[model samples]
Target chain A: AQSVAQPEDQVNVAEGNPLTVKCTYSVSGNPYLFWYVQYPNRGLQFLLKYITGDNLVKGSYGFEAEFNKSQTSFHLKKPSALVSDSALYFCAVRDTDRGSTLGRLYFGRGTQLTVWP
Target chain B: DTAVSQTPKYLVTQMGNDKSIKCEQNLGHDTMYWYKQDSKKFLKIMFSYNNKELIINETVPNRFSPKSPDKAHLNLHINSLELGDSAVYFCASSQDRGQGANVLTFGAGSRLTVL
Candidate 1:
């Protein structure tokens, strides 16, 4: 079985300040990881993914995440926060051992990030 | 044109009734999936179809049936809808189950409210 955890239920950060949303995973072999953002009454929008290569993956809207193998963590980070960045974020993982699959993702409960102006 | 689309973005129905959510993808993807997001914002996979063939069916109720008429279209039909079924249904698609990447393009979601 594969699973992900976003330990923080909610993160509060003031505008123009750096922000981080934490995520961790439990799985065997290599894992495919992703981050998605969802606004109220809207579907999730893809952010970034870590398949392999560089430990730090950059995504849209000036967002990036550092993949730490030792920590089993992929934390989303932004240099500066904006009020519009307030939303629910989810971390998901896919197990490659399953098959040549667009593997079924195991999602975390999601973390709500608030950027206060 | 939308890459992945679903009809009736909002569906309000009564318990014991049947309803269908239609999903279509134009990205030439060979794999499609249906996911349920509960009120608490928990996501779970209900079904997956690869090239119109059932691939993964989770521990979902038998009342929930998925129909894939073709590779580009996959529809979800719920029988005797229950209050527990009131949640957001998301339609997603990927290039293929074997393309190595599991990145799914999702629809806006169909909000199902069962009374």
Candidate 2:
């Protein structure tokens, strides 16, 4: 089974500072990773995805994530964090070997990010 | 326009009652899915439908049945709702060609509260 792990429950960062949200995965085959953000009482919005990509993938709202094959990690990053960027972040993984599990994404426990102004 | 939408943004019902959450996607995507977000914010896929066919059915209870009427609509009906079922249910759609991974567009989510 494919699974994702987000180690931190919460992360605090100051405005204009760089921020990082850690994510790791365990999959039997090649992994397709994604990052999504959710505001209070709102549905999740897609940020970016890493599917056989060039490791570092950029996304909406000045966000980016680096897919590390050796580390089995895909960490979301931002050069400068904004107060509005504070939201719940989720890391999900999908196994390339579809088989019976067709287009099913295994999500992480989510991490709350707070950017102080 | 809302690409993906779910009816009854907030649902409050008593235990043992049955309720249904409706979802529709105007994105013309052939694949639709239902995901449950627990109180702890852990998300799990409950069911998936491709072209109105059940493609992925997770280890969900029989009480929770997902019905896809057409290629764009998928509804979830839960019988004998329990307090543990109180959580936000999200409806998402994607264009999966059975070749590679595709991005999913999610609805605003329906919050279910079983008292």
Candidate 3:
């Protein structure tokens, strides 16, 4: 079975400070990891994904995530936080071994981020 | 234009009533999915369709039925609404089933409130 875990329920950061939302996964095979953001009463917006290659993946809205194979973690990061960046973040994973799942993504309980000015 | 759109952005109905949420994608994707987000912000995939064929059906209740009229349209119909059924339903689509790495485009979401 494949699953994603977001360790934090809420993360608070001051404006201009770096921020991180932690995520880890469990998969039978290689994992395809993704980060998505959701604002108040809105659908999730794709942030970034890590399939293969570079350890660091850059995504929209000046956000990025580092994929650590050894740690089984893909944590969303931002160099400097902005008030607008406050939202709910979710981490999802797809197991490459599960071909029958067919584009099904297993998501974690979202982490709420609050960036204060 | 919205890449993915869902009708009835908000719905409030009494228990025992039946309701449907319609979704459409203009991105020319071959796979579409329905996901439910609970009040605790936990998201779970309910169903998926590839080229209008049911491909993935999670451990969801039989009362929640998903119909894909075409590759671009997927609708969710729920019978006998319950208080526990109140949640946000999201419609999403990806390039194709073969492209597992493709990211999904999601609809704004339909908030359902069952009284």
Candidate 4:
């Protein structure tokens, strides 16, 4: 079965420092990867996606992810972290097999990012 | 206006009660989905509909029924809700199926607490 794994249960980073939340996926066909962030008691918001082309994908709220096909990893990254950037991050993937409806998303358990001042 | 919205953001009901959560998306997308987030914050896809046709149905309980009146609306109704049904439910919509890279627009999830 296709799935995503976020190894880090929690990542603590100091504000203004670089931050990285790791994600690895297992899929059968070409993978369409995505990153989403959720603040406390809020809905998951779209951050970025890797469909095709471009190994580095930039997204909203100054977030980006690097897609590595050989390693089957799509790690979320940020140059400088902010105190407000603390939230739960999820990595999801969908296989582009024939007749795939493109609705169901296999999501990771989520990584909690804590950017402290 | 919220692009995707789910009614009754917080639902507290007794076990065995039948309840329904209504969802509407104004993004003009062709596909809609329901995702369940467990107490551990693990997200899983429960059901999906494209243009009012059921396309994806995961290993969900038969008590959970989804109705898509149109492309813009997909409602979920649970019969004899069990205590294990307590979780956060999210409604999402995306463009047409087979769009290679479908970006989903999600609503503020409805928190269901079955006591």
Candidate 4 chain A has its poorest 10 consecutive residues by lDDT at A95-104
After aligning candidate 2 to the native by TM-score, how far in Å is the CA of B79 from where it should be?
0.9
Off by over 4 Å in 4: A99-103, B97-101
Residue-by-residue lDDT tens digits, candidate 4, B4-106: 9999899999999999999999988989999999999999999999889998999999999999989999999999999999999999989864542378888
Model 2, residue A76: distance off in Å is 0.5
Tens digits of per-residue lDDT for model 3 on B1-115?
A: 9999999999999999999999999988988999999989899999999999998899999999999989999999999999999999999999854543368889999999999
Model-by-model lDDT, in order? 0.92, 0.92, 0.92, 0.92
> What's model 1's lDDT at A40?
91
User: What is the number of backbone collisions in each predicted candidate, taken in the order shown?
Assistant: 0, 0, 0, 0
| CAPRI quality band, candidate 4 | medium
Judged by whole-model lDDT over C-alpha atoms, candidate 1 comes out at: 0.92
- Model 2 residue B54 CA deviation (Å) reads 0.5
DockQ metric, candidate 2: 0.67
- The better candidate by DockQ, 2 or 4, is 4
Pairs that collide in candidate 1 are none
Error of 3 at A56 (Å): 0.7
In the range A1-117, model 2's lDDT, one tens digit per residue, is 778999999999999999999999999988889999999998899999988759999999999999999999999999999999999999999866755435678899999999999
